[model samples]
Target chain A: MARTRLTPEREHELYTAVLDLLGEVGYEALTMDAVAARTRSSKATLYRQWGSKAELVVRALRNDKPVHLAEIDTGTLRGDFLAVLGRSDDCRMEKNSALLRGLSHAVHDNPDLFQALRELLIEPEMTGLQLLLERAVERGEVRPDNPALSYVPHMMIGAFAARELIDERPVDRAFLLDYAESVVFPALGV
Target chain B: MARTRLTPEREHELYTAVLDLLGEVGYEALTMDAVAARTRSSKATLYRQWGSKAELVVRALRNDKPVHLAEIDTGTLRGDFLAVLGRSDDCRMEKNSALLRGLSHAVHDNPDLFQALRELLIEPEMTGLQLLLERAVERGEVRPDNPALSYVPHMMIGAFAARELIDERPVDRAFLLDYAESVVFPALGV
Candidate 1:
């Protein structure tokens, strides 16, 4: 008999279930058994498709967090930055921060998960931001070799994420926006 | 007969043994058995004196790392940054980073270890950095309300240390100093 093909709807259900489980149980606590149970799939099915908890979760996260930042190429640097950074009034950044902690912890322990996490999830956002910076550089808004650009994003996002994970505090939108505008943008020479 | 009072020489020997064991096995791998084996000290003595691994390691690191720059009072912002950041270049910072990871992994998992490690080791360094920033603000070097100041030290230094620990890469003085001059100084102004 031919293998049963998983429809797009089925895939969506599994991936969505993975993300919901992630938010509930956290990355470290996520188990293959749990994923299989939540999605009403067999353990053998989950195991055959994704070798480990980390791989499944990382892929699920990448699929779930489709960055939908509207590409607004406002002429001015401030306009561009505000366009990118102003969305934080909705508290998505805080949710993203928690997701980052889960991802970082997952990556630290599993090399395959690390590569997938960075390549699929992190690189896209980083590339998008870098494109934003490239536009500014073209516009001559900042110095060509401003060193703060190197670690500014990681510092702002990583610091907030790390602190929240370690301290169990909320990563609020106002706080994230404040940091992006006041600290990150300034460091980047925006 | 009363237990023999440990002379300074005996204490130094014990500290060296602890550090050696720390470098080799790290915090998790380290055990009272290993420490006792390395130092040829009774495990009872270790328990009686330090109470736990956090206490023992904290005392060991403090004793081992020579106090270099604290309470930096340089007139200029650049000058002050150099003073504090320069200390990170010392050999002590190398051991310090390893010590941090060893301790961070432990404390992150166990609340008792977390409180103990924070109180004994991490708090002092954080306090020092905070005071240095406070002084800089008082002297008109940075804005009074720069919230980034709260996490700036961690952002710069912690990011570097974290990257090193995460990537298992070389973290040298020249690289860090350049980061200080570029990323750190710019972030301070805005």
Candidate 2:
């Protein structure tokens, strides 16, 4: 029998279910059977669509992102960063943080998932951030020779990863905004 | 049977074995049985000593750190930072980073593990770092009101967490020294 094609809406629903399950049980414990039950879809269809659990989870995470960094341009680096933070509300950011935390362990153990994350999630975000930095340089806001330029992604990502571990606080817009004003912007000497 | 006490050397051997197993199988797949067999100890003794796998893993990780930041003081913050980096060679840093990445995910799902990590590993590190920063402030090297002071640990830790994720690089002394000079020092205006 030919596999039924899913509508875009149906795909979104499936992804949402996957993310919900991922958040609840984590990547290690999340199962295709559970995902199928949650989404009311057959396990075969999911496997057919995503190839494996790693692919499916990565795709679901990729789809969950509402804004692409490439699409953000506010003429100033600070403005652009603020715009990026504004893309997700506090609740959504918290949920995404939990999801990412859940996947962090899985990525280390599973090479396929790490590859998928790099290709689908990390690469796009890096490209978008690079574009933003280039534009800032073109605008003479950031020095092209700044040593800190290469470390920007690391700094931003570290902020997200270390927040809960360091301060026992969630990564919220206020913290990010403050980080930008104090730590990041000064490092860039902007 | 009364639990036989392990000598300090034997305890060190056991912790080393636990860390090895953790690196091999990760936190979720790691079993007390595997640890006991690997260390030539009984499961009952393992349980009695550590109370649980979470506690055992956390203790092993804590024991792995050779340096405490509080003991690092070179009169200059930059010198102090460099001294801290010098504590771990590249190979040890790489192993530690891998262990940390593996544990990052486990900490999220297991509250008991998280609590153990906080009480044993994180709190001491944070306190040591705080002492360093306070000394810097006292020396007038950093302004007392600098907002960046509080975020120093976040930035340093973020660099460690983000290195592999962003650049596929290990957190080494060279990278950290460069990071301290370019990103961290400048942010503090020192």
Candidate 3:
């Protein structure tokens, strides 16, 4: 479907509104009417531009991502992982983590949101991570037959999900870097 | 405050209804009226017995736990980990995992719910895990100062949260056992 275009600044304003609303009310309670009201746009305009709430939210989240993991090539797995952490400061990471927790239920319930997340968000990151692992394997930093190789994404994502639950702490660059050195690197046999 | 008591069988019926409603409508959408309607009880009864939705839901979840980690001691950390997985079959595990995913947002949003979960569910489990780790430390399986020791809960819970997100697969006994052997055990140098 063809889409109407908003000016870059206007689009940024709208996406920011969507994220702020999402943070406040959560995905289950978020509505197109609210988005329209928040952005001072008509619901018709939102639907015309983004097609659905799922698409709009997913797109906003996609836009909010500061770095695409696929673009980072630090020539070493450890450096690549650290670079990903370095892209976001502690406060942003905490907010993003909260945002993700808020969306976890929505992702489980909404197939369209899950599809959009996989397509636009998860897939790109997974691909980038895979590249890093592949490079590690080629460098003999890790073995090809290591079963943990398949679980790299799980391990990384788990660090985010389990931090607050287990330790009552927000995941930060320092914690994650320490995790990478102690948990991930050792698991990979590096 | 003194609590109204229901018979064990009737209490089970009420908790089952609560969990069923929770699974169907989610925590945000779930209401005491719906719980009362489902269980054929008055809303007053639910309130009197559980005090609040968060307490009721947390209690129901606590009741639903098949294994208390503190009770499991198979002589090895690996055995203890596998035993926790063994308590729930694949289907139940998947259901519990989905229930957790459904509660993820609610846990973040509701302080009462989070508090109840930490007290009733998470604290018990963490204590049990700590016992197992302490045993390992005593056995000299893991070094006392290992930083990864602090992250064991993160890694295990991450395995649960990341399974569907990363691989589009449900977390199961086999997968968790493999994760224990590959990712977790290796990280601890066991």
Best by lDDT: 2
lDDT of 3 by residue, B1-190 (tens): 5666799999988888899999998999999999998888999888888889999998898888888989998888888887887788998778877887778667766889988888888998889889889999899989998878988888887788788777778988888889989999999989
The DockQ leader among the candidates is 2
lDDT for predicted candidate 3 compared with the true structure = 0.86
**Which number leads on TM-score?**
2
In model 2, what is the error at residue A173, expressed in angstroms?
0.9
The better-scoring model by lDDT among 2 and 3 is 2
* Span of 10 residues, lowest total lDDT, candidate 3 chain A: A100-109
User: Residues A109-174, candidate 3, lDDT per residue (tens digit)?
Assistant: 698998888887888888888887898899888999998998888888878877776767899989
Question: What is the Cα-based TM-score of model 3?
Answer: 0.84
Q: What shift in Å separates residue A95 of candidate 1 from its native position after superposition?
A: 5.1
- Predicted candidate 1 versus true structure: per-residue lDDT over A125-171, tens digit per residue: 67776777677778888677878666655565555644553344676
Fraction of the reference Cα-Cα interface contacts (below 8 Å) that each candidate reproduces: 0.33, 0.81, 0.90
lDDT of 2 at A90: 92
Count clashing residue pairs in model 2: 1
CAPRI-style docking class of model 2 based on DockQ: medium
What TM-score would each prediction reach against the true structure?
0.82, 0.86, 0.84
Clashes of each: 0, 1, 1
